[model samples]
Target: MGQPPINSTGEARTIPVIEARGVDHYYEGQGGWNHALSNLNLTIPHEEFLCIVGPSGCGKSTFLKIVMGLLKPMRGQVLLEGKPIEGPGTDRGVVFQEPALFAWRTVIENVEFGLQMQKVPKAEARRRAQEVLDVVGLGHVTDLYPYQLSGGMRARVAVARAWALRSANLLLMDEPFAAIDAINRMALQDYLVDTWMKDRRTVIYITHDIDEAVYLGDRILLMRPSPGRIGRFFEVNAPRPRDRSSAEFAELKGLITEEMHRFSSENTSIQEDAA
Candidate 1:
């Protein structure tokens, strides 16, 4: 599905719902410090659908972790709702590539996990869980366990769980649709777009799929691999429910592909020259 129109009047807008300023992350290992992210700056406006795309090993997952408060930046800051993030909270929900559902819990139980942790009343939690389950079209499977459902269904449950925690202004998704089959992935994409249209929640989606990024994102941020850094950012001007086969669609895809190839080849040349 296509994204909603963004207000272009350029008024003094409120602070971004999520902001990463000069984010530099590194992992101290036996070998040395592995720089995962390098001087990154990104801002996600409220209710905006932003996609981050990069080559493999470009620290896309690490970026998501930083945003979700699962990891801290060594030399930068991550702010959500204008507050510095120090730990995970119910205010931010994550849907990973794999559905990390508890094996023993039923669908409804899994959906209510966060609320239960926060000491929400059992009755209220269940009611909210049921409402979100219906939103994600998984109301009928509330009694079933994760193993009983197909991959797509499991993903739906995960989305439902995230939606149930409505306090979260940001949803961090790391290739949530990558594992599903093409048909089901497309269906879920439509479902997600519909839900976004209704609720206008801020979403930051990370993926390697260029078409998927272009199709779903209001703006696509592209990064390069070695010492991950932003390479380019593209604002998608295509109309809602974009047509993949449209002339403009193919043109933009081709252009982005060429840019990606150019970046990749340049990096390869640099490596070879260094060697």
Candidate 2:
């Protein structure tokens, strides 16, 4: 397991590795500009696993894109290591819902693609790619093509591909497990924790599943919809390898669920009042 995080309340102050300041995003619509995020502010400390949770259309994915530098916010900035994010960089790695593996490439070759683009030597790229594939439990299938793998195996390859990008300091996952079956999803979750524990890469995970948010995040952020904004941040005080069957896990899950219900109810009422 990796070293314990430094963000606890009683610990010495830690500098945030990522900071979102007054972030706002919008899209043009016939009704005028449709706001997606509104003056959002957040700070992610080093080596933290932060889970973003919200109802549909809360802009979780959009917020993630802003951080990934794939989408620019209409107003505000996303900073990585104190520098503003201008566009995609090697510092961030993303794993999306679809595996997006290249059908023509073998598993390890697919992982090596990005490194090759940067003109790293072929032998070195192969070495690094295989190392990360092994980390994600896909090393044994390095020779197989995407079409030859199961859904879960393909997802592992996708994650391995991202992790292979040695420059990545942060891993952004946008509902990456949404397509997997229940058993595979749980196993992948554990695998992810293991990987993180081993490497301690900062992770920003977005999901609609309450249990997942609770189980995986060092802290979970609940967001409000209709122009998404931060609602609350709940710290997970439970120890590692949290017991889902235990009362503590159930209580924390119930607490977040209750607050989410309240937030959604409040948001709906405000919209109705405006209408």
Candidate 3:
């Protein structure tokens, strides 16, 4: 069994938002079969902010894709709200690295698009869109097109669009701010944290940045590669509106970072030995 999901208070949460059981995935590549995930087991509690970090090819994105129902694990099952995920559904929403906003649509319209596709009444869709926009501090620019907005602003729009889904209780974000400049990326993280604070939703955020994982995650899950699997979990005990430069924050970040480096070094050594 994987480590049970725990809250910042170190109490095990009773309600599980996501459960992965003995998951294993593979694909045929130029290098022959590649095991992307191996014997992965995890549980995410309701409304918990879980950040996944690892070196490249560590199955962070693969596990997230499984949760989003975009890919199926060959050997195990993933359950959302206690139901097996067969395919994509409204219960989940995803934001990729690119905002991928409709170039022609304004910010509010982009946010409303998904709800409208779900056949939500227009007025209600607009209401929900505007409400989440306000949460992400994007209400003022709702009428602006994607091209007209800064990268950070556009990122916020993407977040708002996913968050606007009234039925999407789980939000899977894959390095949503990875493309932004450093200063703006930090700003966007703050906006995300603020939005999450207002409306708690089960979140699985995949990022390569250790500092980012520490700043945003309630619990940081570190995965090891080769055949990607859980390495460890680090609980972020710091209070919300976390002080990034505080000693506590630094200590946690450093610990996770060090573990990741160790994984990378070990993998590199194995490859060299095989060569």
Candidate 4:
């Protein structure tokens, strides 16, 4: 769903949910400090589902961390709702590559974990957790423990857990379905989109899969490696429940794949030249 930039007064009021201004990060690597991100800048508007795709060493995860406030960049700043992000806070909820569900906890309990941590009343936490689980089609499985749930179910639980945090307006996902099989991955993607539609939130999803990015993102940000920077951004205007086999989908996927290949080829040439 496209969001209009205008407000009640009929004037423009489009403050971004997340903004990165001249962000730069470095890490100690094999040869002194390596540039992980360089002069990167981006802005994600309210309720925008933005997917970031690129090859390894492209600082996709690094950028996610900057947004997450897990690591501070060497230069520049990241802003959330127009304020600088100083550290991790409840305003942002995260899902990682692994579901990392608590084996000792049931599905409902797992989803309620974050709410409880925020000092929400037990009854309210359970209620919200159950509500979110139901939205993701996991209501029947709420009583089941993590170990009893299949990989796909576990993934759904992870998503529900993040979505259950009512105060968190931004959801940051880092390849949450990467470990699942192809069929299950697609199924989880559908579930995620359904949940997103039900309750819109600003989302930053990082993945290596081009098709996944195109399928889920309102806009796709492609990054280049060797001092990771913004390469390009693609707007997915095909509308949801996107047809994966359609010509439009295929064309967008092809364009992103071609750009990724170009980055890879350029990196290879640089390595050869260095040798």
Candidate 5:
């Protein structure tokens, strides 16, 4: 089945799954305060894929952390399911840029780690792990160690591990495909889309690549750095299994590119004026 169609209101039809209200984050250093995020407000609907794109040093990752409860915001609030986020929970799953697999553990074992922490029965966890491995096309390599697998294979294992935890409603991906080569990156992108269609899990993907954002997101959020805040938001109107080479895809990409260039230029001008 394809993704749910965008609604006439220009918002995803699903219910609000995650909500950030006036979220702000800051870190105090020796010299002064560093503002990572400021007055950020967004609502991610259930089972929708939202991608965040911005320039380097933008607080995209920081925003993800605030949502994940890894870092407490200095101001404002982040709510998951209407309750405040306190710390990490099994309800949310995260896929980092690195594979972060244990070298000694076999692929199946690595995927089973989360289940083990939950005290799930070994047999049940193993069964579920096998199923997820199959979903990611890693069934044949389940017994291999991380070192024995190719980079793409390793990334698949990471994805499988995350998906194996079926209870997770929110998936936070921080540039998960950035480290891979072009071929593997594209392949994994397709795999992600396929899996998302089947699972219908809510995803918050962070990336600097405009094409990746356009390809994956139901709505794309652009952020500005040096006091990170929302710059613009775009609803992707293209149909599923989007044709990257099509005129519509190119047009959207061009529009986002121009906005990014303007944002960068404005930031430069502001810095020069301050100096």
Candidate 6:
């Protein structure tokens, strides 16, 4: 409930829960040094759902890791709640492309795994795990092993685990439902929106699907590949529980698609002119 520093002009601003400034990162590979991210910056206020979408080679995932402190930026700093993120901390929760569940652990157990490791009281952990599982619609399969569940069920369990384990200020997701089929993907998207609405944590979600971004993000930031940089950004002014089939939703999606095309065209022109 603290606030950001007041500016000279005397306007008050709510401090962003997360802020990245002048972030640049690179990697050395067989092809020589490759820049993964370059001078990227953004600020996310409390409980904002910011989805990042870009082409394959863009550093969406890289940026997510940087935010998580799973990896450090070569340059620039990421701050969480006004303090610099030095490394992975309990304030962050992450869901990856794969469920990464323990094959032997049953659904409830998998959801409770992280809490157990953190030494949470057994009864409390089980209670929270059951609550999240029920929320994610996995309560029916709570005793089933990972192998026994369908892909969608596995994805739900993974999400449930992340949500249950921490009272995280930030939730970092990297294409968590991408592996599921379309129907299942839609279901998971609804679940995510519900959970986020209730907890109101600042969430950074990385995905390649434009529809997914449009559906879930309060704003979508598109990235450019190869020395990844933030490109265009658009705010989805639609209301929550957005109607995918509605005209407003279609228009927002169209606007993003058009911007992407224009961006791609300009990039190609610049590349050709240079060549």
- Among these predictions, the greatest lDDT belongs to 4
For residue 147, what is the lDDT in candidate 1?
92
Estimate, for each residue in 139-217, the C-alpha lDDT of model 3 and write its tens digit.
8998988999998898999999999987888999999999999999999999999988887888999999999999999
The CA root-mean-square deviation of candidate 1, after full C-alpha superposition on the true structure, stands at 3.2
Candidate-wise lDDT, in order: 0.85, 0.87, 0.90, 0.91, 0.88, 0.85
Q: How many backbone collisions does model 3 have?
A: 0
Error of 2 at 243 (Å): 1.3
The lDDT of model 3 is: 0.90
What is the RMSD, in Å, between candidate 6 and the native fold over all Cα?
4.1
**Model 4 vs. true fold: TM:** 0.95
Clashes of each: 1, 0, 0, 0, 0, 0
| Residue pairs in collision within model 3 | none
1-275: candidate 4 lDDT, tens digit per residue: 35565534687657888889999999899969889999998988877899999998999999998888899999999999899998988889899889999999999999999998999999999999989998999999889999998999998999999999989989999999999999989999999999998888889999999999999999999999988999999999877899999999999999999988998899899999999
Worst 10 residues of 6 by lDDT: 1-10
TM per prediction: 0.92, 0.92, 0.93, 0.95, 0.93, 0.91
Whose TM-score is higher: candidate 4's or candidate 5's? 4
Residue 151 error for model 1, in Å?
A: 0.8
Q: Which portions of model 5 miss their true places by more than 4 Å?
A: 1-15, 29-31
RMSD of each: 3.2, 3.3, 3.4, 1.9, 3.6, 4.1
- List of clashing residue pairs for candidate 6: none
- Candidate 6 displacement at residue 151 in angstroms: 0.8
Model 5: per-residue Cα lDDT at residue 272: 100
Backbone clash pairs for candidate 2 read: none
Model 1 ranges with Cα > 4 A deviation: 1-13, 28-31
